[model samples]
Target: MQQYLFFSRDISWLGFNGRVLQEAANSSAPLFERIKFLSIYSSNLDEFYRVRFPVLMALANVPKPGEEVTDHRGILNEASQLIARQLDEFGRILQEDLLPGLKRHNIHLIYKEPVPGFLTGAVTDYFYTHVLAFLQPLWLRDYSRKFFPENNKLYLLVVLTGADGAEETAIINIPSDALPRFISLPYNGTQYILFLDDVLKLNLANIFKHYTVTGSYSFKITRDAELELQDEYEGDLAEKIENQIEKRDLGLATRFLYEPGAATRTIFNLAQTLGITSSNMVQGGSYHNLKDLSSLPIGTYKELSYQSWPSVSPKDFNTGLSIFDTIKNRDVILHIPYHSYNPVLRFFNEAAIDADTEEIYVTLYRVASDSRIANALISAARNGKKVTVFVELKARFDEANNLKWSKRMKAAGVKIIYSIPGLKVHAKVALVKKKNNNRTEYFGLLATGNFNEGTARFYTDHILFTANPNLVRELEMLFIFLGYRQHADKYPALQFNHLLVAQFNLQQTFLFLIDREMQHAQRGKPAHIIIKLNNLEEKRMITKLYDASNAGVKVQLMVRSICRLIPGVPGMSENITVTRIVDRYLEHGRIFIFHNNGDTELFMGSADWMNRNIYRRIEVCFPVLDATIKQQLMEIVQLQLNDNVQAVQLNQSGENTEVTNNLPPIASQQEIYNYVKALQA
Candidate 1:
């Protein structure tokens, strides 16, 4: 076999971001969706800097960890170059494609302007009434004592000139949260969309009357988001989390973005005062914070956007019988976004009201801001049913929201479990126990995504509702372990035969499955493997996959974010191919399928192939035992494989190229919706 090493995940992640940029640049995509992609790209980059970029910065500050380590500064510098190119493409797309595309539909987004003379009156009124109240200007002469820009907030550095020719610098904060990012102007015929930046720019002198405005340049800062929780797993987690969140804005600045083509004097002066160096300074378009473009109100020209795909109820879940009764006999699997989330919600709501229900168990890593699941759990506790919830306080950006929900659940009599010091309960599972007719039964749910209803509308995930003794008993044991009923040291005795759990048997089980496929290949029988995940960076797992490829096993992967595995190399991984799909719905589910000599076994759950998932976090991967559900999942994967739209083939070169063939166009997200609808029919 040819020699190879895993690609750097940070660089591979940039390749994934490039795929998002590809959608923005694709002419086949709808105009507004293209705009939304730009927003998505910017938002993604902001997060990368907040969360991922710091690792490189830390490495840059210190020496490299190992001989095999990729150059941290080199990768970051390459990222800088990649981002520059992507931003240039973004500018061209907005200027050449989307702007003109919107104009063809009679919607105008005004960027560069000779402002219409007739609209000055409305602009003046808006400035006085809506924008002026939030404006606070700080004179920079006292810069050392009282000037700090909040993270990710847009601001303007204005060079002020007095009549005597002396000048001073002042900083003004843009209150984007208080006012709409795009304001509609009073036009008799043509629709005019103006950014709040230009509105402020046009009226800059008015806001600062004491000095003549020599120049105004826009800029924003991004700060490091990782809150180093010092003391191990001992203290008040919620308090520590809340304290960290309160200090998030004050964290060290990671990126300093300035409007490209801004005055050098203003840029240098502001950068020096803000302690920004060349490494962190990023030159952006005339406006910053364009993620707000996703919310542009174009209600009159809705036809310019892609047709919406409505969520439909699954065929197996629509029976008039109670959901509990339905799951008690046969398993029910749901494809979220394509299928209605009502059954999952009904699981909790029904449990809150069911007289036989004795307890509800849930593990929530991240939940929706206005979570119906949280409300239902609270209701269950209030209705006299015992509810034990594990709210992981260390769930990254969602820490504050989880803290709030945990407090509410705690107040309602629900038992709350905080994050373990060394681990995060990343599993998404829930169990409801019922004592009916002098028999105790368990109805359990295990999902690939969080119990967040808001995200369920746009995140592709699978949840299985089952009463199978094999799956539920193991899940019960796992829950007892989480609830302190069983000691952590006794994790080995559970003997999980049906479930593949992380930190225990998940890795070994997957390796064993690959070995089975290898044996099938050696025996000259049909053998293949299909896996999907958000990331693929586990070295040992990748090596196993390489071994499978060399053994004549056909492997296909759909890694959405970070993929370090190299595919399609002669004699190394020539039998393997990889692709990624980014569309209206995010590809969030993790699925593994092995061809067991024509009897295929399928599984789906919360774990990706990342090292953190395999060794650090609590994750679950359960089998799709029902034949019909297994077939459905197989069809879903096949459709995604056949997708000609919104799907890109990835290669060892770290490039996400569009899939082109002679077949008809099939967008997997749309096809899956139609497929589920057909099943219901």
Candidate 2:
């Protein structure tokens, strides 16, 4: 027996975020893009506090039965230190680089300074007019029940003193949600942007007319976002989820982030009264919610941003034939964000009105707010076609949006299926059945991302349109199982030869594939494995890959975040290499390739090798049978692997090191865009 090593999932995730910060610090990136990376880092940290931090705290409190307790406290401390350093770097980039860069471009962002003398009048006027109506101030002592700091909502704690020297505190909300976080004012032939916090700071005298404002500190409390749902086989799950969404903000506070320079007594008092533990107290910069920096008014300074690459229309879908007819002839694949998403939209729009169409089945995880796909389904139902949509209401943070779409679709005659009792249907597949001249034709759409066109604009994903009956039949079977909405174990055993579905054959088939590669290596034949995913944390799958690595099968992984397997470890994973890329678009597609001696097998789907995906959810991974599409995927992945710029190699300790060599620089996103555009030409 050999002892294996794995990186802590939380720490590995932090390392991924560190890579994002690196992009922010990269002087070569566009100024606005760097600012955007800062915003992304802030947003990612907030979610980690809301979701993962609570788990860490809970784990620290639990004691093992026989063995020593888990050192969750140590892990938490390490994570905290990493976060503090990252935040320091964040401030450095914002103050030292981004702000000065904006200044060079004739834009002034009022950060920690007082309002410019010329702009004071304009700031006060805007505050009294646009910002006054939403202001609600409460005395911290008097409004105990009336005010609990809502999760992640910004507020200023004002320490006030009467004329007699007696002091008290009041909290006023910063209405960034109601208004823009950055207010732009042009003065003295220069563009000036001010944080809403500063505007409120300048106008505090108007709000508290009688008190002498001694101190003010900005702070926000991040609450746990996990929704606890009862496994009730009886009631309305949608209604239950809706209720939970309403209560999400009121969960236990996981982080109490307050601006530095607040008195120790004041910080502790605020924490005590607000139900926040001292452990949750974190001293931060003057401005919290820097994620709002995404909205910084840089105006039309095109030079401050990356040159936009307009999405190209895929040549295969532009033959002027109907989308169904085109897919009926051969399999079609779209590399999204690089390729225009109009064809995907047209796929459903045509199905809604196509007279021969009789039935449609699909699974939706995260639905766009104004989903054209959902609307098309509603229309298809109205046009007398049977439309069944399995809407996963359990998608984190998007539960409310999904539930909203579910209600509208149900009311419009589409048969909407809610989530199973203990399983989330995360498969992104759609089936369209048509009856033409007493012949039945099926068109299936499978994707490595959500069906939401909104996300497709910025998330790099792949969508496959095929008329293969083998894959379509397996997809139909999965949808039928989802319709039951029972516990996964209660469903009948399903046999899928063509599709790898979780909770059934997904994990097993993946293990079997790795085993085949190991066997090939044992026979002294060429063997290799290539995979790309958003996350890879499933232990069994990783161990199997380690087995393959030890057996001389080369493994290459492009994991965007949260990879646990330690690559380049001697005799364990020495043959495995992990590469991470962060660039203009979010890398999101899941691709897996196996070198079966001389024959290569390729797959792309919605599944990531995570515990929840493999054991607790309904996921689908499908094979790429079309030779042309397979070759294209292989070529694109090779471009990514060869990338020197915007790509990093992860070592055994999970640290991201720059991918450097004597080869010429290759930014894969740009190269892939050129590749796809050339194909169009």
Candidate 3:
């Protein structure tokens, strides 16, 4: 049954976490933003069972025909049956619709079988002052080796039953990483709360004062967060990524979960002492780290969350000048969470304290851990320019904070490369160089995300900035082919007529602009295309946008995450459509548009037509060439195609639906942050 052509990128990332459990079962969101979208769908299913279900259970123990293996047990039994039908539609939208719509807004969450006499004296004074001094029970017959357990935390287990009837087991631990898994009690104003696993299940008889508790449960395990780079037998690739981040907390037990009336012999003796089998345990639902409902204290209902707007910053983009004389006077874009990522960290802190700057370069795939853009490239390598950087030491989960900011930007002398071993520069480009009198001009910046001013306040990225000397000589020939010191076939003057890049010319410039909008929909003229990606998943660019939607070409799309193309599908994608917005920021810009015959050919950066961003990583994209930043990115993609409140649609069986378009509801990230705050008023 493994003939799957697509739709198993972990079941399209659990159908994009069931479109984030349809925005936490959207009952017109806002009720602690549907419990912060069910705590980001239980923190994206606990990092998809800790990093993609242990790489599909280590590719279901290999040994297959020709071994290009993709059926990791049919994508882990269709990602554990689409994560048990999205955790039974996230437990019927959190126990029959958001705990009865947060008790009709008076808010309440006290779960474990009704224990709510105004939260029993503030959960018995928070279990005698902060969870009985960090609980410590052990007894599974004197559990040794310092009682193991410490991945994805939480524990409980118990079972006792002595007095000569026979039975014993113990474990406890759940000091929810030292408290606060939702406490807030004393509420005469009617709010209440609780579940620090029912405050350690009503303080289990003050930590088993010599046994007989009966049947506690809880559970959690997760592990296998896969980070095994020996750095090609290390010579010090940042001490082999700081010794695989200290052996990534002893990685290996992938997913145990439990507490669905647990105790099948305590889930088979804790899955045979945590080596976990029977297809990695699971049972679930007594709330094992519901990704701590992303700090769900439900705070006395600030109109049930999701409101705070602030992030527009473009008073004509001039936070007191010299951002290289305002991108040398023209092309400026910026747009993230509607604008300010402080002009891409003030264009590298004003060209690292510009004294006619000199040479900078940059690439860094991700940043921010005390990064004022890595302290302005370590203050422009201590004011002696000619920098370099690259850095992407495998950026997934920011490889130990980019190997501790690449050994503090290589002890502040700066050069640093460490990336291209099978390419992953993810092009965010930088450039700089100055000293003009006797030559050397360049300036550039280009981005799409990650010069990370803390994920530019919720990721709707788009940088740009330019001095435009032919795009700073094609971004100094892509930092001389990412500093392998030239040899992108010895840079033919880094020719990128107008940049699409990735392994040179993003998939033949996006299949020659979707065959110029399928030759203007076969000469009927005025064809269209739009785009705005985050992921469309590359099936030859979704079968060339389903052959420009069977040559009628009115595409659309907007895809914010893993869309394995399947628009309307009548005659294969009825003139395509797609959607998926998920509000409160994070649409992470990519743009595209193409009605070429109608002179609408715009483009935006940091590519994502996938297939590892167009044939393996070094992405770029470009061409918005500025007619007031292409009419401000076509008015933020026509206000996210007139969002009927946090969009959705994507159908053709990959259901996300929810876009009842009548048109008066527009919530494209609060109407493109009030149309870029009314263009800075």
Best by TM-score: 2
Better of 2 and 3 by lDDT: 2
- Provide the overall lDDT of each model, using Cα atoms, as 2-decimal numbers: 0.87, 0.92, 0.77
Compose the digit string of candidate 2's lDDT tens values, residues 1-681: 887878888999999999999999999999999999999999999999999999888777774567334578888888999999999999999999999999998899999988888898999999988999999999888867658889999999999998888898999999999999999998777899999999999989999999999888999999999999866645888888998899999999999999988789988998888878888989999999888988898899898899999999998988999999899899999999999999889999999999999999989999999999999999999999999998999999999999989999999999888888877889999999899899988889999999999999899999999999999988888877776545344665679999999988999998999999999999999999999999999888999999999999999999999999999999999999999999989999999999999799999999999999999888899999999999999999999999899999999779999898668989999999999999899
For candidate 1, the TM-score is 0.97
Best candidate, lDDT: 2
* Candidate ranking (TM-score, best to worst): 2, 1, 3
Residue 667 displacement (Å), model 2? 0.2
| TM-score against native, each model | 0.97, 0.98, 0.34
Clashes of each: 0, 0, 1
**Pick by TM-score: 1 or 3, better one:** 1
Flag regions of model 2 displaced more than 4 Å.
63-70, 486-492
lDDT for residue 570 in candidate 1, whole number 0-100: 80
CA-RMSD of model 3: 24.0
